[model samples]
Every structure is written in structure tokens, then in C-alpha cells.
Target: MSGSRLGPEWVPGPDGLLSRHAARVILLDPSGRVLLVRGHDADEPERSWWFTVGGGLEPGESPRAAAVRETAEETGLELRPEQLEGPVLTRSAIFDFFRVTCRQEEQFFLARLAGGTATELSDAGWTAGEREVLDEMRWWDVAELEAELAGGAVVYPSNLPALVRSLLTGWDGSCAHLGEVEE
Candidate 1:
């Protein structure tokens, strides 16, 4: 993987819309806070949203590999593949970015960063384009996140807080499809 290439590949799907397979991780700290990225459409800054720390899988890259790579790239926290737990949850959604609409299939993993805190992140790891759309990155506890959602801020995988809670309880090693996020 080259550092210069982290964007999504928009391929046409059966419904005739562009599609992409992506990997996302719910990065947790010791306090149970999950890291989230805040950003907006590059062409429309007002259309902001918050999402987990991961991105598009490179061609032929396994989901775990993409998770590790994307976690490192997006959060500057390099993690070994084995450290990531159950993909726990999978979500499908159709969203727009840079004026192109895409059907995104994403898998979510659970990874813990012992003693890690939000301050460890810096702008140095982001791509120029990422920095442009991304306003900030922060660690959010479920209540804080839920408030944001209720307050009208967008967070992908609408059931995120519930999903994270499920991860906390423990998984039997089975990945569940969370169904679609109706656009």
C-alpha cells in the first residue's frame, strides 16, 4: 500500500449505483471511549458527518489488513492484525461524497488501545484531501455520541452505540450483518 492512495474505488453495482467495499474500526481506549472522525463533503462543507476510523480496502486486501492499515493511516495508531477483535458488525449504506453517490459495504472491528487517549492523534498522518474534509477527531463515550445523534449530527452505522455495547459484552466470534442504513 502506498501512502498516497487511500481513496475509495467507485465501481458500479447491480442497482446501477457506484459501490465500494470498506473497512472501519471502532477504536477504543481504556475508558471505553471510541474514536470518531468529523468531516463533511469536500464540495459541501455544511454536510458534515462523523464515522469510525477506517477506509476503503485496496484491491485484494483482506478486511483485517485494511482495518490495520486504515487505523494506522487515519488515527496514527498502528495495530497488529491479531489485536483487532470480531468485525463484530457490518453495515451497508448509500452515501454521497464529492458529488458521487456510492453504495458502501463496511465491516467494523473492535480494537483497544491501552492507556491511549485522543491527544495522541495529530494532523501529520492525514492525506491532504482528508485534512480538507476532516475538521477534527475525538474520543466519544456512548452518551456523548448518542447526544450528537439526537442533536442532529450524523454518525454512520446508526446503531453504533448499541453495536459498541454489544462488543463490550463479548462476542461468540460470529459477525452479524446489521442490515442497511436507509438513505
Candidate 2:
């Protein structure tokens, strides 16, 4: 798979990259805070509330490609991933992926954007405190995310806080020890 190149199909073009449909949550690390989108162009108050840049898989497109695309469209960031844990979200019990047995499992991939911008934010930026739409674009510490989980505040479909935490932990060490860096 060394000299191969993948097309937009699940057939593993030439590079040998896996062909799986997935979603990506782009976490922008600024000086000490992380960047997040509110709502789309139509939601209430309405745009980038407590969310990150993301979208569904496109035909033939890999999850990493999707992640890069989303960060550009959503945050206008023109950066690539530092690394990631490929995730599959499905009802196929988490234990199933381990070789057990399960029903269904949807898949998702996550990446973090370090330095880059959209040139024009659709109301984009960072969060230090809280806002009406987001309670604020907070560069939350790992504890905050854990707290949200403990309190059960992740009610948004597109907002996968726990999953995000998991990916971050996979990349770094612990979500609780994650450092908030801003650009």
C-alpha cells in the first residue's frame, strides 16, 4: 500500500487507505483555548452554539478528507490533522469492535486543527467565558467536559462531547490534562 493512491471509493484505490464513511469533529487549539462553531446558519440565536466543525461522509470520501474539509468550511482553517483514532458510532455495542458480537455500529473520525482560519468567520472565534448560544466559546479544561458528562449536558446530535473527549484522550493522554492552545 506504500505507493498506492486512494480514489473516492471504498475499494482502496492504490494507497491502501480504508474506504469507510465517517464524521469528524475538528478541535482548534488556540493559545490556551479551543475553537468551536455555534449553530449552522439557521439554528436559534443561531449558529455555532456548543459545537465543532463536522459533517457526514460523502460518497467515496474518507473520514480524514471529511475532517479537513469541515475545518475549512466551518472554521476556514487550512490545516491537516496531527493524528487521530478513527471512530465508528453504531448500535453494534462498543464491545463488538473488540471481536465479540454486536448489532450495528456507525463510524466517525476526529482530528484537531492547530493553526489556520477561514479568513472570514461566520461568527467564528474562541471562548473564554460563556455565551447565550454556547455559554461561551470556552477553551474548556478536561474537567469541564467530564463535568458536562456527569451532568448530562450533551444533548446535541452534532455535538459529541464525550466522543470528542475520547478522541482527544487517544491523541494526547487524558482529556483532563489537555492543554488549551489558541492561535
Candidate 3:
């Protein structure tokens, strides 16, 4: 089997099933708030905490490409190359992750989008089935975002927002540099 893994960089696992790397883009608005979407999965009265907008890396696709695709799909916002940030961490796929006893983590990237109302599009397919899946979209200040996490309203591998808070702490907001945690 002479095939290559997707993404520009590839790593092989013991099973020989190629390890896939994907990227996610988290955009911050001017007030130092971050953008997140309410995951469509929650059926309870409460909604899933806000999530950064983005998706999966396709075959032969770059993390950047996946980020672009996810953002466009989830929010209908098209992102330029200038908007993306760092690839934070590379994680295992869910099935393999549990098999290995560690949750799969996605590579998180920081992004900046021109602030304004996001054009709500489509039927809220995956993130929100019909418009119901998306539930709604909202921006949360660091403290509030943290609060949701503390209350366990949010999900994991999103250990991201906490890290983002740390990185942006004391930031005057003009800085564009992003740091990372290697795979």
C-alpha cells in the first residue's frame, strides 16, 4: 500500500492507518472576546458551550484548507490567509484516541475576522441540524467563557480557550504572534 496521509505533514501509527491532522480556527473580536458556535449535538434544555468556528482536514488537504472549509461551512465566512494563527496541538482521531486512552485533540489555530454580524446560512447541517442544530451563535468574554467551562457546559480538547486566555493575558490586542504545544 503506497499511499500518503492527508495534510502537508504526515505521521504513521503502528496500525499503518495514517494519522490524520486537522486544524481549527478561533477568531477573536475587538473587545478581546472570542467567537464560538453552539454545537448542534446537545438535546438537553441547555446548549453546548460556544465553539470556535472550523472543521476537519480532508484528504490531501492542508490544515489551513480544513480551517477554511470548516469556517465557511459553520459560519459562511470566508477567511483569507492573513487571518490564521498557530497550529496549537495535533491530536488523535476519536476512535483511536479512546483506543489509546487519550482523547483526540485537534490542532488549534488563532484567527482574526473582521467584526460584524455573521451571515447565517444553509440549514445548520452538522453543527446545527436545520437552524436548530446551531442553536445560536454568541461571543463570550474570557471570564464568561471560563465560567461555562467551569460549570461543565462545554466540551474538552477545547483546553484551548484556557490557553488562549493565558496567551492573551495582559495583551493590548495588537499582537499577532501565537505560541504552541507540539504533538
Q: Give the number of the best model, judged by lDDT.
A: 1
Local accuracy of candidate 2 as per-residue lDDT tens digits, 24-96? 4535353223455443222223323354455445677776777666556655456565454444232111111
Model 3, 1-183: lDDT tens per residue?
223212233345565544545577766765667767775333443434455666556678777778877777776667776577666444554432212221223666776545584534443335323245456666677788778878877643456566668645443344232333222
* Pairs clashing within candidate 1: none
Instruction: List RMSD in Å for every model shown.
Output: 3.4, 12.7, 6.9
Candidate 3, residue 96: lDDT: 27
Q: Estimated TM-score per prediction? A: 0.88, 0.43, 0.61
Candidate 2 wrongly placed segments (more than 4 Å): 1-22, 26-35, 40-49, 88-106, 113-138, 146-183
The 10 consecutive residues of candidate 1 with the worst lDDT sum are: 1-10
Computed on alpha carbons, the lDDT of every model, listed in order, comes to 0.81, 0.41, 0.56
What are the runs in model 1 whose C-alpha is more than 4 Å off? 1-8, 116-119
The positional error of residue 107 in candidate 1, measured at the CA in angstroms, is 1.0
TM-score of 2: 0.43
